[model samples]
Target: MPGLSLWLSPPPESSLYRALQDLITDLAGSVPAKDAPVFYPHITITSNIPIECDADEVVAFAASHWAADALATVTIMDFGPAFFKKLFLRIRKTPALTQLARECREKYVYGLATAEEGDPADQAAVWAQDEFDPHLSLLYTNSWPFSDEQKAEFGAKVQTVLETHSTEWTGGLLTLVPTYRSVDEWKPLASQLVGSE
Candidate 1:
């Protein structure tokens, strides 16, 4: 299987999720107002792989390896927004999440490479190293309605969110995203996280 990566994202009730949604409403006035398909607010647990991976198998593997669900309490304790030209929120690495990522990647995902090894496009993904970046994307690809100064100000505002918002990873859906290399092509694969409540 290929195209399997874990994700940490907002439950509908999350403050951070709402804040970004609010920003989207604000930007609707000026910009075209669509988040990049893969750019919705999410922290990637893993990424970069071929597309033929079995979704159900990946989910089953993750559920089996995890410690019977866990505290969804997560925090983005560090600031200083970084982006690939677009800005994103970064978090200090936590052993719990890192361990979760490694187990899934090494056990389930790593083995799937051979499934797509012969296809030229798939081979590129198999050879590439997918690094984990614990982050929540705040903005991507000039899609927001804010001006440059506004963008700066928007980023600055999020610094406050990073500073004050400590969130509990309450039980929410386990989201799986597809990589047709486009958001339109990607679909969410989800399971309920055993929440902190």
Candidate 2:
């Protein structure tokens, strides 16, 4: 089964992009140079188990949700230690984002569910369910449980990096990607600019 996900891709000129590059560069110094995952900065709106839906339908839903705004603004408010097993930049949840997530889940996810569908229960949980603490991951890996001293040192480094950068970004692209295994395998099925025709 293909793993589908919705993502907000930050524009290249945004300060958030530059900050993410800097963070990746700094983090790369901590591990073997080849071990760092290829960086593609984005805030995942939701992830779903391979639902049979038209790609155009998914793109249309995203475009319609943000119809009035030419760009969706995201704020990177703070640096967090870990989420979903990776260090990340915590995003301040805004109503626009929250609503967008809700619509994606309702229209694409839960709306596709059926009683006879063999255990749709195992699909990834919907976003914006209880709390919408959106975040942009800075690192992606399975390694875990660093030594206390190492964690402290790395935490300080991440803090220092955050202090030097701006927090906000205007993302113009919404994409539907299908992944086979790792994030590196994600292939864009369709894309739409936030508000353009």
Candidate 3:
């Protein structure tokens, strides 16, 4: 029942990506296994791909439809408290990225369906809840959801590490990842160059 999702990952060759990856690994190491999990640094485009859909078809759809000369420059804006976004860096949005997200949603989520058909009304309602708010999660933790003190402490640690690295993520891979039952189980299914012709 695991669904598919799309993410924009910084080029592995980029220094920024290496720094962020190390930060995530280090932070993930500090938290207990049940509290937080380690994940790659990525700006999620959409995480609503239905489990019923074909992965290869989705990958091909994205490959043919989406093309970007360069991904938006990601800036570490602020911190958040959501479980998936626990101690995360909010990224600045760009027109190209926004458009790309919308197109992906139209295909995978909306399923090219009208308001009255394809998906049931209730199902449609559920899919509509996801909005394209781009962010690069530094930690995925559930322990400090309501603890401001803990969140601030972690945020300070994140800020300290970020200050020593470049925050700009310009371009990378457009990847299709499976959203499994656990973060550790998730992995990329397909990927294409963002700026390739």
Candidate 4:
């Protein structure tokens, strides 16, 4: 079972990527010395559940719905701790960003129902339509579990690093990835440039 997902990645040379690298380094250093997995800076558009579907068809559906004018001027607004002891840099969600995500879900992940199928309501309800909380993850604490006191102290340190290097980046690309169990196992299936109308 392959888990597919759509994501927006910043160019490696971009300031956003640099900031993310710095934050990750800072977080990694604060944690107990242990192996930490590194991942690209991205904002997830949709996380596909394991289902029987053609990968090419999925790519085509995403390509058709890709909005060239939906390039979002993303801002690193703040920092926060998430579930699973992960720290992330919160992004200011814009209308373009939300609409882009919704469009991807509606067109590709959740399609219109047929009369014979009676709306496929169960599947249609999988993805969220509420407010989008976009962020770039800095690191996960699985390797170095933290106590409540440690979490508070580490969270404050993360916040300090984020505040010191607030960043802005324009997102113009959407990528389809076949995700496996680990971050290192994710492989790109397709990518489409989305910008400039």
Candidate 5:
């Protein structure tokens, strides 16, 4: 059965959120639909929570553990060309961010097993398989091996937009979303604001 996942993202009201949306709009216009698809900015905390995991349980877990503090600041390091990671901002993983991800996986993915905390080897694993390298993706490509020219074009476009802003952003809304379908089909089941009452 398909499952749910946790996503940490900038709330719509934030300037960083608006800037990312604008960048998505600009980039989406140029790429052919078959090449890539636009998506909201997010750093996935955990993917493929068992469908049996109650949505409310997950939301409450996140809220209780993380609501008192804002999410860790994320810095855009560079760009990459992998399919899901196509034209993405590589994020600098901070200790707080790593801890957040580990907690999520412990409760949801590994069923609270200390021995099962996520492994770095899993970083190359597919989406359903777990890892904790955090990044805010800008584009999702349908095809593999995007030509160098195309990748370079996308990189230039990304740099042109992001160069004007600091690479770091902090705080976000945490959401539980069903991950059983296409990107466009996925929607949030519940959400909580970090560091907000």
Candidate 6:
């Protein structure tokens, strides 16, 4: 991989990820093609750098970049949508997930050169740094056809649904895999966590 960044997300059991997937799948079924792919359950901790790909490279990367034992606890309570009009499951646990996200965020700052803007090589973009407001995205829509009333009602409905079913996530597993551009695709690589730190 030339341009890559470490990503952090709740493990499979995280209510946040599961809820987000369901929400997006249901809503995305009606949205445009551009909107459907945005539904992937992710809270990108850091990005914007061009690097190389190799098992050795990633192993060395994990050794220097990844954190070994960090506890990530997050709760899904409120329903919120991203600026893109996609709804998300919000984290309301006073940053139970922030600590883990920070480790990944720092990896970007320290690992390699951040990618140049306008370069077609970048896989993701930086919206803000370390302001890891973790939310699981659920919907995507254009701004042109939305009104205040629609947004408010959508949020309220989503919040009500989340309140009905949210699960606790703990004992996280850290897996360093290649960042892929598509579901049926992934670049192969391995990561090793630095032991000396």
CA RMSD, predictions in order: 6.1, 4.7, 4.0, 4.6, 4.8, 7.3
Runs with alpha carbons beyond 4 Å of true place in candidate 4 = 33-35, 49-85, 112-128, 143-166
Task: Rank candidates, lDDT, best first.
Answer: 3, 5, 2, 4, 1, 6
- The digit string of per-residue lDDT tens for model 3 on 21-81 reads 8888877876754567778888888776876777777766765666555455647645555
Candidate 2 lDDT tens digits, 103-130: 7766677657785643333332334657
- Kindly report the root-mean-square deviation of model 5 from the true structure over all alpha carbons: 4.8
Clashing pairs in 3: none
- Off-target runs (Cα >4 Å) in candidate 6 are 13-16, 30-34, 49-85, 92-99, 114-131, 172-197
How would you encode candidate 1's per-residue C-alpha lDDT over 1-197 as one tens digit per residue?
Answer: 13645666666577766765555334333334454333455566666434566666666666555553443444442323332225555644555555656666654455554654455333334433345556655554445334668566665665565566655454444556774445455566654443425
Residue 168 lDDT, candidate 3, scale 0-100:
62
User: Which should have the higher TM-score, number 1 or number 3?
Assistant: 3
Alpha carbon RMSD to native, model 1: 6.1
Give candidate 4's error at residue 25 in angstroms.
Answer: 4.9
After superposition, the stretches of candidate 1 with alpha carbons farther than 4 Å from their true spots are: 1-4, 24-39, 67-85, 114-130, 142-151, 160-171
Candidate 4 least-lDDT 10 residues: 76-85
User: Which tens-of-lDDT digit does each residue in 1-197 have in candidate 6?
Assistant: 22554444555455666665676566656444444443355444444333453435443543344444443333543433444335555544233345444444344443343445333222112323324466545564543344567557656656655676544343332334444344324333443223223
lDDT of 5 by residue, 4-115 (tens): 8888887668777888878876766767666556667788888868776778779778767773444445465344556667667767666566667766766677663345
Per-model CA lDDT versus the true structure: 0.52, 0.63, 0.70, 0.59, 0.69, 0.45
Worst-scoring 10-residue span by lDDT in model 3: 120-129
TM-score of each: 0.64, 0.72, 0.78, 0.67, 0.79, 0.54
Q: Where does candidate 6 clash, by residue pair?
A: 2-51, 59-192, 62-192, 62-193, 63-192, 63-193, 63-194, 86-139, 87-139
